[model samples]
Target chain A: MTVTLASLSQQTGLAVLDHLERSASIPVVHGLQAQGDLIVIPLPVIASSVKVWPDSHWKDVPGEGVELLRGAAGGNPHTLVADPGTCRWTTHVLDSDQLAIGVFETSAVAYLLHPEHGATGCPPGTYVIRRQREHEGQRARLVAD
Target chain B: MRREAAEIREEWLGRALSTLPADRPAAEAAISGLYHLIGLAPPRFHWVSSPVTALTTVPPGIRTRPSETADRVSAWPLPSQFSSLMRQLCLALDAQVRWGHQSMDRLIRQKVRSPLALSTEGSLRMPLLAAHDSRHRFQSTWYDTQCVSWIAHYDALRRAAGVLFTPEQNRQLDLWAAVARSGGWWWPREGACVISERPVTMRTEVCGDDGEVRLHSADSPAVRYADGWDVHAWHGTRVPSWVITDPSVQRIGREANVEVRRCAIEHIGWASYIDQAGLRLVASAPDPGNPGSELRLYDMRRETRVLLAVNGSVERDGQRRRYGLTVPGFLDDPIAAAGWTYGLSAEQYSLLLRRT
Candidate 1:
């Protein structure tokens, strides 16, 4: 079945901009993709710098969705959604940059949705979700686009 | 319970940031009751338009000793007694919070109390503290004692969570709540009590999960008092009026406080700041993992560089936004500088990935 933004939003009970093309099917990218301030990276690609704990407690992604992160000023949450049991998520991970928000492993395609960013599909795989950051002066600050 | 606590928290925050004319009689009565609780008669009341005026002017008929001067604002014994009285009241109310409601109390503390405290710090207390004779030199217990957060905490405990308070505790709580709901800051002396009126106008932006707010206005003073005292802020950071009304590259360069400097630069827009400040170009590279986005690095100042990157996503108007991040000057590669922001090496960040 083809998955458009409207279908994705309807399935997850999330809202997207009316201006965004809602009828076109969203692409399920097999490679790394960034959605606003969140980046999805194949775990092995950054295996040297990031690691998932061997005993990490993982939870199934619900039909409604799992909120990965919210913008610092409160609006616009980055929600990860997938068919129930298709994706599992865990926040237990180590990153040298301290930017990793969590790790997700999927048996089938999963999607990351944001009100402003629309949605992007992640093909079945294990990936590390990292937040984007910027240095203000000497200190690094997370980007909440 | 958490939801109701949030409602009560917002209600108190509204009172804390109130701009209405102070309820003179209500404030006087509550303060007089507080004075009586300490076994003393209410002192003569004098009202000022702002905390600055309250601190600077001598209330009529009062001569301050060296120790009782506004400079020693936190050292006043009257405030200390009131602080003790509030603590005692909290202990009494806390005891009434049964074991079942103890967990609810803790939840309210986090959801209601803590966020309100932060909002008060940002919107009200900080301004009051800024009005102190010596900035950053005095303890803030007296100010904290007057803050409505803790008062609202117990109020929420009773009204929202259904926790009970003794009649006496309720009476005492009513007095404190009335004071909070009625006026602004206060300074008590043996024979005279000075209080401040609320600001004539104020502006703020909600900046937290629990509806917490901070002083913010792009064009004028975020907070303004009837007596002409006012404060400007950018986002939540207290800043000079120029930073809001007339931010200049030279002024941003001269600012010593990094947060204030950052606010100025942001007010000018990062892209414009880079151009106006004449930051030197260091390097440029296509950002790895985020295709189509280019990273450009510029030499900002001593030992620090700025990385300019394009956001991966398109905006509602279909334009991509550009933002800058300061980085160590030693990194010559823009991609590496971008990677460094996430505490990763260039190679680690270059992995085939996707950015929206």
Candidate 2:
């Protein structure tokens, strides 16, 4: 499922509350927009392997990872980095027009876990957890190649 | 706290008295609203020139007059009665209104902490959906928040009259008040003080961003609206369900040969005594041949105190009706009944018979 600012802004507070009350976690297909093109990538890939901060971007090991260039690859990019631990799930309406989705912390990724390259490799591509069969005390499965 | 209570009492009384012309209509409106808040019908009130004199000697029905003739109204300003009224009103109000925010509960606590703040002037807005009734001379309208002021005012009058009751008798009065307020149908069921209502089950399910469906079993009943759900659970039982009429006078009446059910589970094993003319145990008995339980009668105010051995029959004496008390066999103390009875398990006897 694709989530855009328009689609998210249209959702009601009750819907948001229902999700927060019953769901342990949500799966988001995250990426970044630069210039104009979009670079689809897994959150764990960047949070663990790159020196990605709130304002600063990879200026070029850009490491030994896959180079994902979207739109014009040279312009400064705006991104939202959410710490899975700190994000609050609520349906509180902050204002009449603006609904609070949640808060995200911008932090640097020091290591990325890879099946073959241990915790030092940064793999490219969008990844998400299979939430269909998830139950209490059960963790989501990483569905990324 | 004493000073605060004093302030509350003073302020509440002042606000209550100030709200009216204090006519029969005004008094009736307040009383009607209080009854409606608790989902009860208005009791038949016989108008008297002086309610103070009339109420001094009374039967089952309680009496009250308007605030205009302030001196005529009895049972005001007494701590025990006033506090009891406050507590009762709070309970009834809680059951009727559904709040939108948790902050509302906190606000009520703060406002009602001192009785003075518990007036219609308080910030709480409790709007009860009133339907039209053409039967009455005039349509009755009452809000729970507004009723607090009246309760304070009337109870202060009761205090001034120097009305007093023993703790046990007070408990009975409270019970009678609840019954009267709830239109005489509210009773104890499954450890819950509930009006006549059916049971319900609530299930919560969410569709995740990944299109996955998650199911949850919720104990509270919830309302689904525009993507949000508000849950409401039965908040256990309210106190004062016990009515102690005509103090304990041992009377060993007819023997109703009723079978007593064994107390199996803790929640199921209970009994109660409702004093109709005199004290009689109301309990459910185990059916030896049938699968479920039966109605067994027990008289608490007797030396024998055994199950009234009546063969499944309601015994009546002339103008007096002697209904069998459906009490649980597990209860060692007769006074501990919950105004209802439950079926007991076979192993429950060991638990009950076990001498500690």
Candidate 3:
């Protein structure tokens, strides 16, 4: 399926709902996750939530949170998602070889990966799992079957 | 014949002696003429015997001392021979004068044309030249009597031959001899002898800002500083004005003061420094009372002076030179300021600053 801002925004909204259900605290939506070469979420949702969070805290959360989620996802059977103001992830596999991941702020999935298993050689790729929106909204996700 | 000549000589001598003091001027003239026959001044005589004693004794014979009894005796003959010779020559010239056949010049030339030998003891002999020039010969050579007398007195023969004492010469000789015998003579031949123990005095005067002048008597306890060198401030404070110890620095300081004063009525900065090359003296015109300070650089060996700079480059005589390595801080000490004021050696600059 084609990755799109609308799909990413839907995924981010679901990620925020999961976080709120788990903690029962409103997750402060700072900004959309920015992955390399993609605007993960549609722009309208990220812009709309930016108003609710303090500028300082909001600026720090999205960039740092995306990095944590990417780390949690690891490399196998991982699902990554972002909304306009939230990011989420889950992973279930590990190898003797470790993987390196980086998260960046963007309107897309905002994740980057290399396939050399953290060694000397690998091909690199980036993808958007969600899109930011001008208002608070759900995020989209990508799943490896 | 010989007896008759002898008798004539004796008669002449007697006449000459009678004409002496009694006709004092003529006698003096006659004595002067005799001295001319010789080539020297008349002999000064010393009396071996006191005149008073010699006159009072009234000896029957010529009162001669036995050779063995006398303490000393002159090798030359008695003064009588000199007297006899002068008298004979004078008598001859006198006759020539009476005859009026020849000029006085002719008379003297005829008498003194031959050189005479003056003998002293057995050793010294001097040749007496005739005073008269034969080329100028004239009649009645008796007019040359003056020359005859002078030569005769100076002739070595007469000096070697004791001088005859007139009573006056005898008295002077007697006094001198007594003084010499008593060992009481102390006459220096030339120059005076003085004894003094006073120390030399040097005074220094310094003008203060308050218009009061402080005078330092250098004589008391002088603060002497070496030029081109630095002494501690404590040492300098004792003196009236700072004494520059280094000759080179001292010279530059003196020149700088004079030059600065002449630049204008404004306050002028003067300074000196030394380096490998030589001394440098620099002056700048500034406000009066707040005159800019001077800087100097001196080369000790070459004794040269050059201007230097301080905080900024200083233009001296239309040229700008950088001050020494240490700047802004160097300005604090007068010596340092002086040094920095002009790019100068540390020693030279410091010395000048001390003076300020």
Candidate 4:
């Protein structure tokens, strides 16, 4: 049974749902958060959740996948998690050190050994981060020349 | 200075009368010629300018006959009235002359002041005294030159009056006498008089002699008279004429052409109103103090002199209307060309000339 991280998160706490949904794939959830009016979801969950999530949520979600979602959600201290395949969980990753703990979870299917590996599997709704990287590169090149 | 001018004017009047023509025809010709020169139609003549032609050594062909003469003449019953008019004219002329002299004197005094440096305050200082001097100079020049023409006119009138009438036919003198007694030919009394045949916008007020003031529209029938020395004022784009009892009260009602002395307690005098006719008439008197104080005729056409008791009442169908006022149409006569030309600045004269 394939279930979106958003559906699992709605049924359970964000931490427990994330652990289940990211068992084998990145899970993305798009909707309002419990803390404020802002929208929050895991970056990797977009690709896994897009087909299952409601059409309204999919429309308002950013187009460049999970990297963009992380960029918007990154600065604040709050953590989030995602799974790219199978049963997805929308969960929080509390810190950079805690990202390793996901390998021990019962539903874990793959473990990203490096942050770069997570970047390579980035899901949808993360275009803003890519654009920001491209803009910085252009500015750096012009200054150098 | 005005009194001096008046004395000189009286002497000139006597000289002018002595120069009159003895022959009726010559007298009539000369008088008619003078009238034409001054822009008036020939007046009716009796024994002096017509039948009395044989009494003087004037040629019969030289006389200009009147278009028509009344079969009878009215008696000269208003002697004091006539004399008063003459006195007013003399007084006006005297005032004009005195004003010119005084203005010149003022200019000279101003010129004697030391010139000041152009500091910030100095730069801001007004040049009023200099302007006044220039104005006075202009007046003095005009008066000195044009006064002769005025004297000539007076002379001509005196001689014509002497030669144009016989003792028996001199009743016409009563008309002139009445005009004089009423304060010259164009003098309007100091009060309100019905002046126009048309309705107009008007404002009226009761101004106390002690300085109390009130105002209203002319359409209102009830108006409180100003107390003794108090003045009832009225003015507007169009004003209905009414009677004024006291000359002083009328003077107080005037609101224009007033000048204050430097002392802040003396007004120079009131401005005169010269109607389209050659009549120089008094319009108002200035307050003793207050330089800016003046009486203005909102409707010049509607302001008229109030005939006094001395001039008698208006008569209608052999019935006497007591305490009446008269407005002389002679000023409005088609041939009359009266106006103020002397004692004005170039700009002022231009304005007057344009209006005329």
Candidate 2 scores a chain A TM-score of: 0.17
lDDT of 3 by residue, A1-145 (tens): 4433233334333222121112221122223222211122222332322222122122322332232222111221122333345332222212111111222233433322111111010012221123111100121122110
Off by more than 4 A, model 2: A1-28, A31-96, A106-145, B1-130, B133-177, B180-356
TM-score of 4: 0.13
Best by lDDT: 1
Worst 10 residues of 3 chain A by lDDT: A114-123
- Ten residues in sequence with the least summed lDDT for candidate 3 chain B: B121-130
Candidate 1 runs further than 4 Å off: A53-55, B1-3, B69-72, B133-138, B288-293
Residue A70 in candidate 4 has what lDDT?
Answer: 21
Question: lDDT tens digits, residues B189-225, model 3?
Answer: 0111011111122122322211111223322322111
For candidate 4, the docking band is incorrect
Q: Model 4 over residues B1-356: C-alpha lDDT tens digits? A: 33333343334322221222233444444434333433456544433221112112223333312421111101111222323434455454334334335553332222211111111011111111121222232222211111222332233233322223343223333323222222100101111111101011112332221111122333341122121111122221111223122223244345332211100101111222222222334342221111223221212224332211110111224332222122222222111111111111222212211100
lDDT of 3 at B255: 42
Candidate 3 Cα outliers beyond 4 Å, as residue runs: A1-145, B1-202, B209-211, B215-245, B248-272, B275-356
Worst 10 residues of 2 chain B by lDDT: B124-133
Q: What is the TM-score of chain B alone in each candidate?
A: 0.96, 0.21, 0.15, 0.16
RMSD of each: 2.3, 27.5, 52.4, 44.3
Which candidate would rank higher by DockQ, 2 or 3? 2
The alpha-carbon lDDT assigned to residue A106 of candidate 2 equals: 24
